[model samples]
Target: MDFTYSEEQQMLADSLRRFIDTEYTFEARRKSARQGESLDRGVWNKLAEMGVLGLTVPADFGGFGEGAASQLVVQRELGRGLVLEPVTPSGVMAAAVLSAHGSDAQKQEWLPAIASGERIVTLAYLEPTTRYRPESARASAERSGDGYVISGTKSVVWHGAAADAYLLTARVSGSNEIALFLVPRDSKGLGVTAYPTIDGLRAADLSLQNVAVPASALVGQPADGLAALGVGLEHGIAALCAEGAGAMEKLIQITGEYLGTRQQFGKPLASFQALQHRMADMLVQKELALSMAYVAAQALDETDPAARRRMLSAAKVTVARAGRFVGQQAVQLHGGMGMTDELSVGDYFKRLTMLDQLLGDSDYHLQRFGEVMEA
Candidate 1:
């Protein structure tokens, strides 16, 4: 399959890059990080005006009527900019989930606002002990008079505190089956505590004490909640791989420029043959990672389960390895300044570290890859 970006996609990327460079510098990111809040409303509105927030929403819902590839392009640019916006949660995860499983009424109610970036939504799937398995959720939604009462705690929900609504995953009463509920953030008995992550992104812990929602809130078949979650997970992994590839590219570029200008023993550090070889290695790893990311993005719609598993696992593993290598090498080449917050390289390192852990780490994907091969 052809992986070359279309002209429109390239133009979109260039526009986003230009805007981010001019308006969202590392200093701006640092200020936001220190503020310990969700993204600034003004910047988010600008993104909406740029049409990025609606890249994936269907046109009928006031979106651009794009697909996963378009979303991937936007995410890659966000990564390159070191942006702290909650694009993955709101754009990819929540939007994709709603598009795939929401009833017509549910779609009409939520999609327009979400597509316009007037509303932010987040996924509440992780439990205290669930680790990386969406199916391991123990949160229960019990049938009540005219609706369901949900009681559980969700850990590390991306943008949970600032979200207008939550896409909650819970088990149905008396069964291992799973379901998703669209619970408003201000619902009665819902408690939220949010903070900035080490990488400067917002995350929250949610406590639902018998929070209730009408049956219309449920997305997809109750028993097929796990399946819907799986689709979201796959898309998430693909987007992450693309983001990692972009990070790796930035790391390589920044390190190269630093070496070219920094002097060692009366000569530029880039004059060293050994360092050149290392940079070459970083480039190779980044290229391979990009290839895997593209393949995984295309494979997300594959009909065969085994093929999907294999491609996604491969993409994750490739990204993890390349991300680690690029981050470590960038730090090493930059000497002491690489670890300091004043430098963008250090922030890149932290962001890449968080990406390494999100969804699944390197070892996790490696094991999954082995399993696919064994089967």
Candidate 2:
């Protein structure tokens, strides 16, 4: 099979790459993070104008409705820049959930705005106590006179401070059935405490004390919540894999340049055979990760749920391990300066570390891959 990107995919990647290299420099990114800004509406609108924010939304909703492989192309570019925008959460994850399960009116209202970047949405599901197991959620929703009252605390909601709304997950009161709802950011009894992640991105802790929404806010039947959640997560992991690949690629370049320039014992560090071998190993890991990212992206279209799950799990495990190795080696090769905040290498390493834990770490997905193979 041909591995080259299609013309459209290559164009999209090139457009995004140019923007990152010219506009969103490392200093600009650090400035935004220092100010505690989660979503830069100006930058987001620019991305929207580029049609990137709508890459996954259906054509009926003013989007290109591109598939996972196309999404991987876009995300890899974002990763190279260490972009702080919540593109994956709002663009990929929320769009996937809405397109898959939202009602006609709901789609009509949200999709267009999301496509235009007029509004931002993200998934809020993980609880403080849930670890990474979304299925073990304790948040609850109760019927209340043609509406539902939801109460829960969601931890580390991606770009939560900037979201105009959230797709929240809650268990039906007194039942095992989990459900999804669209909660407005300004809804009464809802509180958001924003903070910067170690990776220089923003996240929030959400407090929902008896927040109420109309029955129309329900995304799908209670029984469908977990499946929908699973769909969202699978899309998220694919994006992360692609992003990790881009970040690793850039990190390797930075290390390579540093070694060629930084003198050691009256010669360049690149002259050392030991470090050359380490760089060679880093390249191998990066190639392996890029291949697995393609595997995960292609697997998104698999018709069989079991087959899809297995491929996604396998890709996640492989990419996560590759990311860990590439990140650690990149830092070590850069020496002590690599760990300092002044350099971008340390920031890339931090992002790579967080990516592993975001949608289940290497250990978790390795076990899942084994379970699926046995099944």
Question: Each model's TM-score, in the order given?
Answer: 0.97, 0.97
Report the lDDT of model 2 for residue 167. 91
What are the per-residue Cα lDDT tens digits for candidate 2 across 147-178? 99999899989889999999999998878988
Location of the lowest summed lDDT over 10 successive residues in candidate 2: 1-10
Model 2 spans with C-alpha error above 4 angstroms: 1-3
The lDDT of each candidate is: 0.86, 0.90
Q: Pick the candidate with the highest lDDT.
A: 2
lDDT of 2 at 326: 92
Report model 1's TM-score to 2 decimal places. Answer: 0.97
Candidate 2 TM-score, true structure as reference: 0.97
Candidate 1: deviation at residue 2, Å?
2.7
